[model samples]
Target: MISMHKIFRRLIVFSILLQLLIACPLQAFAESEEAIFAGGCFWCLEHDLEKLDGVVSAESGYSGGDLINPTYQDHSGHQEVVKVVFDSDIISYKDLLKQYWVNIDPFDNNGQFCDRGYSYKPVIFTSNQEQKRDAKESQETISVGLNIPLEQLKVDIVESKVFWLAENYHQDFAVKNPLKYNFYRSSCGRDNRLKKVWGEYKY
Candidate 1:
């Protein structure tokens, strides 16, 4: 089981950010805000983030690859990413980063959930110096809460780039193909493994 101290710390971090958002919900995104992450199944992240109130849209795609416009079959080397678009008015990028931090094991620096490959590695793509700083600082927060060394986590914080959305079928795979999505999620050992790693913060 994960340590109670850590869960308490993360909860503190999450609550602090949410309080900031709730205080300033109308501070909308200055532009077409974007945040991309590669954490195992895009379908899972897509489904989860889409449920948030301020999230305008979320698309599954491939990033940090040599090839552009990659497909699921063609994503042999690229990490599957979820491109999230949100309105700043309803929430803040800092809060989004907080949620992202809670969702995966950043320490592995490899694949997330059941996947074990560079293609499934977790990363954050930021748009500016502010985001760069925020992502880095947030990584530190996660590292402290999880008792993971900074260098061991090895999370990448790169500049944001264009994202070519995955095929339509992958857009809403979880909803369109619930059974298959559930099977993929289960087979990946994501929930089970996460439960083992994170029982108290099993949200």
Candidate 2:
């Protein structure tokens, strides 16, 4: 039979182990971060960013405008954006910024590809100073690499505003309606434009 002292010691060890296990996951969760970007067609942007390994989720949303409870039909000032949750341990924000650049037509201030309007315009909404700094630096890098002037790189890097989640039907539309999503993407000339703007370098 086990002694009382042995049982007490075992319980102590077990409690410490449980605490450690709980703390580890909490620590890892703390590393999770959010990033917001608008590159036209929230469905496309949401689908594109979610393909990255470290990204936990990419949800379609509307942001960068004063509109409250914005929806798909009438989001006048708001731009269609993707809110990306990623594990910083696996992928840094700088890496994400690089990926964003190649996927967009930086010269198009009016909108991206076939989607023309204020809602379809490209933007990088930085939530903090670090993100803002990284975004501006990435913009500069893209300008130099593409041989375009800073003013010509139309992708705006600005402060992030309230990101209202889009309607449930809009979220994960690509995964839900693969055929329709593929047809729309192809017809919209998104990939073709990306290829022309970025050559063979895109994510």
Which structure among the candidates has the greatest TM-score?
2
TM for candidate 2 is: 0.87
Q: Candidate 1 on 1-203: residue-level lDDT in tens?
A: 98999999999999998888888644452455778987778898888787787888889998887787688888765788999998877768888887776666766667887778888888898878988998998878767766768787767888776677899998978899999999998888777776675567522
At residue 82, what lDDT does model 2 achieve? Answer: 95
Predicted model with the maximum lDDT: 2
Model 1: CA > 4 A from native: 1-32, 201-203
Residue 165 error for model 2, in Å?
A: 0.5
Least well predicted 10-residue stretch by lDDT in candidate 1: 24-33
What lDDT does model 1 reach? Answer: 0.80
Question: lDDT of model 1 at residue 26?
Answer: 46
Q: Which stretches of candidate 2 lie over 4 Å from their true place?
A: 1-30, 201-203
Instruction: Give residue 133's lDDT in candidate 1 (0 to 100).
Output: 95
Candidate 1: the clashing residue pairs are 25-89, 28-88, 28-89, 29-88
- What would the TM-scores of all predictions be? 0.78, 0.87
